[model samples]
Target: MRLHFLGANKQVTGSRYRLEAAGLNILIDCGMFQERPFLKRNWNDPPFPPESIDFLLLTHAHLDHVGLVPRLVSQGFNKPIITVEPSVDLAEIVMLDAARIQEEDAQYKAKRHQKEGRRPKHTASPLYTVNDAKKALPLFRGVKFREPVQLNDQVTVTFREAGHILGSAFLEIAVKQNNATRRIVFSGDLGQWSTPLINDPTPLDTADCVVMESTYGDRSHKDAGTIEEQLANIITDTTQRGGNVVIPTFAVERAQELIYYMGKLIESQRIPTLPVYLDSPMAINVTELFHRYCRYLNEESRCNFEQRQTPDLKFPSLRLARTAKESIAINNIKGTNIILSSSGMCTGGRIKHHLRRDITNPNATILFVGYQAQGTLGRQIVNGDPEVRIHGRHWPVKAKIAQIFGMSAHGDRDDLLHWLTAAKQPPKQLFLTHGEEDAATALAATIKEKLGLKVTVPDYEQTIDLT
Candidate 1:
């Protein structure tokens, strides 16, 4: 058996892994590269031939994990991609959204190319179109949790609750090769425990080989209880002087999580019932999905699920901004509104407009609810950048920009350690992926020192033989 580390090895963006065992070829995740330079590389041609792989098993619908499917299919990969039901549903939104951005970005780059009197550095073709994304949709085979299905003669796969987002999972694979039976685990973006809507990550009894993620390996999250308090304090301080709150959140989990917390803050009388505009139409779609799949929610989250539909379940101030005109309306809106927008990392989206408008106000607050990848605007703001460029214009950062650490969907260092403690026995070797160099290296050291286990952080596109 051979395991190939294709992408997202030491870096946080693209996530693709290949496995060859018992004459079966499979990929764990076929994600896309993101952020500057990394995202720019997406047009360089296929990293590896997508047609050669047998199947893709996605953990969730995050673009970084499932964004490349359309491109893969467009390049003649005619294989069924399998995931849980919610992931399949959410992928519809995520990939289509990503496709639109890719289209716009390519057009922008091509126009600049024309100005330079040169053919575009990149082909004007997008990674895939919305139609392409939809074409790939029917290929999805949604499996229920813990149900093991044979992918081919070589392997059987099971999904474990990752607790990160709705329908997120860690895959467990059992392989039969060369008259030997082996079981391995892929920790697909482990989620923190006690998160609002999802159950805790399922514990593993043991594995022979393990692939883990270390997104927050160097740090521990703040106490979860303080999230609301910090949020309330930021809101009160910012809005007391009549400033708006701009939250750059992921349209999927992070956006909904903010809504949950904001709902709490409002219901608990922690903050005044200011208008909370969900500026992304895609995010509004995801909220309806949550309502459709209410069974996936935690006990508390489900309690809010209407057994009987009540018009009051929808908040009057909870405005859904679907069209471009509505999004632009937010720019001129005034007085103590909390507008949660997307591209959580502030890379691109309507949030950039909000940031440009609100960041110049001394009393406005820019709140971050998730991990911002390096080279993104949200990270720069968190790092105290005094000025930032938005849609080709410079915006001064006079707003009170702040972040709450505990709101991350990914499990922190402590949570990873706690998850490992239940392993009963450590694997022969652990490979850490899905993190920046510093975080992955730090996690590798901690896993060895604290857990007395062997671990290595693999480089991108490196391959290892499991003979």
Candidate 2:
């Protein structure tokens, strides 16, 4: 068997992998490159023929993990896209939103380039159209967790809960060759332990080889218990100053977690009753999905909903701004309020609009509750860039910048170590991916030193043979 590290090898954004075994080609993920340095990769042709792959396996609905499906389909990938059932619903919402955004961005860029009397190196069309996204949707095949599905005579696969977001999963694949069976485990973005909305990552007993994520391999998160207190303080300080608390959130897990915490804070009277606006239509749709799949949530969140006789995500002061006009109206409100919007990394979305409007207000607070990839607008703002370009104009950074590390959905160094300890026996080899160079290297060293396991941090497009 051979493994190809296509993307997310020594970086935090794009994530793709290919496995060639038992005369079959399986692609793990086909994600978009979001970091500025790799953005051109999105327009490049697939390194391998799309038609040559037999099947596609999606780990979750995050854009960095599943954003390029439409583009792949447009390039002739015609096989079934398999994932957990809830991920199908979420992926549809995510992909359609991505398509709309790409279309809008393409049009805007074209007009601006024309005004500047120059043309872009590439065609000014969207990466893929809405119709392409629709074409990819029907090919999705959702399965129940832990059910073994035979892919062919030599391969059987099972999905286990990853606990990162709704319907996120890690894949356990067994491949048979020459009367021997070898097991491979893929850790698909493991979540933090005891997270509020999602269950803990499922523990695995054994595998011949393991491919894991190391997004936070270099540091530990703050005490999770203090997250609520930190959020309360930020909100209180910003509201007291009569300024909005603008947050750039991921439409999936991060946005929901924020709402869950805010609801708890309000119920306990730990924070004042300030109007809170959910300003992205895509995030609003995801919030509704949370209701539909409430049973999948953690025990505490499920119990909270049961006791309240209402969704835990809803609170008296919360408002869903689903229309553009409603979003615009949020700026007209006189008093202090809280606004949560997405794309989490501020690569695009309504969050940029919110940032542009409030970034110059020293009283305002721009809160980031998730990881910001290098070269992203969120990273620039968080790194204290004096000025940032938004909507074709430079904006000064006068707002207070804040972050709550404990609230991140991804697991930290200790959490990753704890997850590894669940293995009954250390695998023959462990490969770390989906992190920056420093993070992956740090994790590889730790696993080798502390666990006495053979570890490697693969480079982009590097291939490894497993025998």
Model 2 lDDT per residue over 23-122, tens place: 9999997888999899988888888999999989998999988999999999999999999988999999999999988888888878988888987746
lDDT of 1 by residue, 365-467 (tens): 8888888888877888999998888765688889887788898889999898888778878788689999999999998888888778878899877889763
lDDT of 1 at 33: 79
Worst 10 residues of 1 by lDDT: 306-315
Clashing pairs in 2: none
Q: Cα miss at 234, model 1 (Å)?
A: 0.6
User: What does candidate 1 score on TM?
Assistant: 0.95
Error of 2 at 427 (Å): 0.8
Q: What would the TM-scores of all predictions be?
A: 0.95, 0.97
Residue 240 shift from truth in candidate 2, angstroms = 1.7
